[model samples]
Target: MQNTIFITGASTGLGKAAAKLFQSKGWQVIATMRNPEKENELNKLENVVVLPLDVSDSVQIDQIVKNVTNKYSVDVVLNNAGYGLIGALEALTDEQISRQLQTNLMGVIRISKAFTPHFREKRKGLFLNITSTFGLIGFPTCSVYSATKFAVDGFSESLASELAQFGIEVKVIAPGGMQTDFAVRSMEVGSHEAYEKLTAEVSKGYSPEKLANYTKVEDVAKIVYEAATDNKKQLRYVAGSDAIALYDERLKLGAEAQVANIKSMFTF
Candidate 1:
């Protein structure tokens, strides 16, 4: 029997790319999106099942897990459904903060909890989490976005330890800027004049040939697929040149020094 993989936020970007690659590799792909009605491409793929899933909704997540468990034996669960919250913390409304934490951090936890029972019962499975380079370092206008990823970083690390006893693995994929609509579509900006210069500086970092440190969706998909199927007991898998640069710097400079270097760039 083919191994079944359940992926969240498969409508576009990394999720969409992973779905295509996994299906191509002969895995049963459960490509889930918030609005499956708007998706046309993935549905056309052979051996790919497009389902509706908004990770923030616990009820919907539970229902989907119940429905899936009976039909396909899911071997991996990819928590890739999240958006970017950019801008100064001062400018973020209560709702914006709540949404960011709920979707990026809480949502990942919710879906993982929903599947824990099944994974434990089988005593085997992989929880592949899609975090970001922002999770490891701080950016000027991406405070909240980075916080969400940082939380996932810790959560995945701890979850890996806890689930290992049950023959399950928790892995986090933290990549740098990818060639996606992340800056445009998946990003929500809360602007403030005090942070305008920093925001502009940060925007320039995403350019193809410069500080933006862009990555390809296909490359990320490959990494995720490998992490899911490699059967290795590794906890963290990182991708992209920019992300590597930051990771190396953090190793050499230590967290405080690295953060100070970033803050030195800003006037505030």
Candidate 2:
């Protein structure tokens, strides 16, 4: 039987690419998005089921899980539905923080919780989360976004250890600066003059326009496929050559040293 996989945020970007790749590789894909009606591209794909799933909505998540369980035995669940909120910690509003957590951190928790029983019952499955390099390293104007990814990184690592006994594998794909609509849709800027200088520096340094020049969306999709299918799975797989280099550098220099380096770059 072909392995069954469910991917969130399948409407576009890495999720969309993964859906196509997995389908071509003969996996049954439950490609989920916020609006299924609008997902014409996914709907047209063979072996792919376009389902409505807004991760923040508990009722919808529960329904999707039950529906998938009834129709197919899901072998893997990819939690990729999330956005980034760029702003200074002090400048960000309570609501903004809540929204970021709800989608990025809490959404992963909710979806994982809903799928746990099924994976436990079957005693075989994979849970892959799409995290970022920011999870391992922090930067300015992305404190809130980094927090969400860091939470995912910690959660997946700990969950992997706990789930190992059950024959279920958990993995995190940490990509750096992929070319996607994520930057345009997920990025936000704070509106405070007090931190305008710092924000401007951040804008110049971490500009999506610049980062897109290096990372491709397909690169992330390929890594996602490897994580999903590899029998000897690692806890974390860093996507992109640039990301791997950065990860190596971060390891060489301890956390304190890395922080100092970043501070010097930003003239902080």
Q: What is the C-alpha lDDT of each candidate?
A: 0.90, 0.88
Candidate 1 Cα deviation (angstroms), residue 263: 1.2
lDDT of 2 by residue, 136-209 (tens): 88888888899999999999989988988999889999998777767677676666777788888877645766
State TM-scores per candidate.
0.96, 0.96
Candidate 2 Cα deviation (angstroms), residue 24: 1.1
Q: For candidate 1, list the clashing residue pairs, or say none.
A: 205-211, 205-212, 206-212
Off by over 4 Å in 2: 205-209
Top candidate, metric lDDT: 1
Error of 2 at 114 (Å): 0.7
